[model samples]
Target: MQEFFMDYGLWLLVGLLVIIALVFLLSGRRKAEQPIEPAVSAEAAPPPAPVPFVDPIIAAPVAAASVVAEPVVVEPVAPAEPVVEPVVEAPEPAPAAPAPAPVEPAPAPVAVVPAVAVVADGEDDLLRLKGVGPKLKALLIDLGITRYAQIAAWNDADIATIDAKLGSFKGRPVRDQWVDQAKYLAAGDIAGFEAKYGKV
Candidate 1:
């Protein structure tokens, strides 16, 4: 081994130094060959604009010079009925019965009047006088007063008996008044009769 080193030692050292220099020269040449490139922007280009369409214009409206007028009317109406009347129907007459054959009145009975002469013009049916209605006549008949003299004969008590028997007359004076009227009737006096009853 010592002998081989001695023989090739210088040649190996020289060959190593030559290889290192060659690598340095090649690295320097690669750096010189690299070029400096100019800088370029990254922005993109814009597209073209679109065309527009035009429309026609319209005119304003015009007004008329004169206007016509219209008229209005109103009518009065009658008011509704305030009250209504009911319809009236007249009553029909009742059918009549056939009358009996006329019988001649029996001759007037002979009166048993006292001897005093009857005044020819004196009213016979004194109850028929004005102011003496059917009710009063019935009262006199119940009291046995067939004539004015009989009524005149009645005392106050007798007249009261008549009143009690007749019950309350719906609208006449008491028995005293009836007796007094009988007395006046016997004398055939109208003024005396009117004094007890109002004007006939």
Candidate 2:
């Protein structure tokens, strides 16, 4: 049913509208050209002439002829046939259908990258993070990770991505609490650093 409607919906709608319009047009003309008020009986006795409604619209020529005008006899055609005025009526409008709602597409996913900060001295000292030594510092620098703030900002995804590249350093960030140390180092909070993880 759905497939049939999908293929022929437009044509069916058009055909229905055409049929409706034709009906209205034919009805209008039929009403306009109705048969005169059921033809008056020809052999029956005729009604009296000079009726007010029939007199004015149909004119009083019969009354005038019946009056003392000329001596000529004007046969009474008074009720020969009934008078009819066809009425034309306006076509009623069809109801309109509501439109369908619009659809919005979903947004695509974006990759999350950790931010790296550079200072006037060059870059933050990754060594300050207790677990990151000179070799790890060099490796971090090579991997474009030069800021303590960057390490502090490592989410699970960032940690996973960097760990995948770190090889031997995998899981080191979590094991040594690098993010906690980096937070203190990034903020230059020496007192806080010593309070938590000993001297800087």
Candidate 3:
């Protein structure tokens, strides 16, 4: 330690001397800084060279953008319930009205009433002829004759047999008025025969 002190003592003295000279020089330079003249005044610092104002050139497209909106797609929804409707049927039209009943016309008036011929019950019409009696009347009716005109048409031989069979018609007038009346009725002269025989 004694050796290091002895060896640096001279160098320390020199550094101190140099430090004192630098202090003096710095003081002189600070005094000289006031000697430099300001020709105009404090405002003479040329207003920081006016920043050359240049407007930005931004280019934009002439046509406007086509702001097309996308179409909205809605998903189809399934039905949640089943619906049933009642059936309606049209009614049948009323039937056509029935036609009125037709009126029946009155029957035509009768002009004349005809007279009907009525033979007496059990009185033999064949008995009015000659040789015809109860027995002959029965036989004549059996032979399909119940009237005097039918008996009068019988020939004389037929009358004779029937008379002989009856045993007593001996004087028969079969060829007289009976035959004449029969001929008249056969000739469609019933009115004349009825007039002569008193309306049988």
lDDT of 1 by residue, 30-66 (tens): 9989997656556745545765643333212222324
Across 86-108, the per-residue lDDT of candidate 3 in tens digits comes to 87878988998998899899765
lDDT of 2 at 118: 56
How far off is residue 6 in model 1, in Å?
A: 99
Ten contiguous residues with the weakest lDDT in model 3: 109-118
Candidate 3 lDDT: 0.58
Q: How many residue pairs clash in each candidate?
A: 0, 0, 0
Model 1 per-residue lDDT at 116: 32
Each model's lDDT comes to 0.61, 0.81, 0.58
Clashing pairs in 3: none
Instruction: Give one digit per residue, the lDDT tens place, for model 2 in 93-131.
Output: 777676767767765434445655656788886777888
| Candidate rank order under TM-score | 2, 1, 3
User: What ranking of all candidate models by lDDT puts the best one first?
Assistant: 2, 1, 3
Error of 2 at 95 (Å): 38
Candidate 3 wrongly placed segments (more than 4 Å)? 1-136, 143-152, 173-176
Candidate 2 least-lDDT 10 residues: 107-116
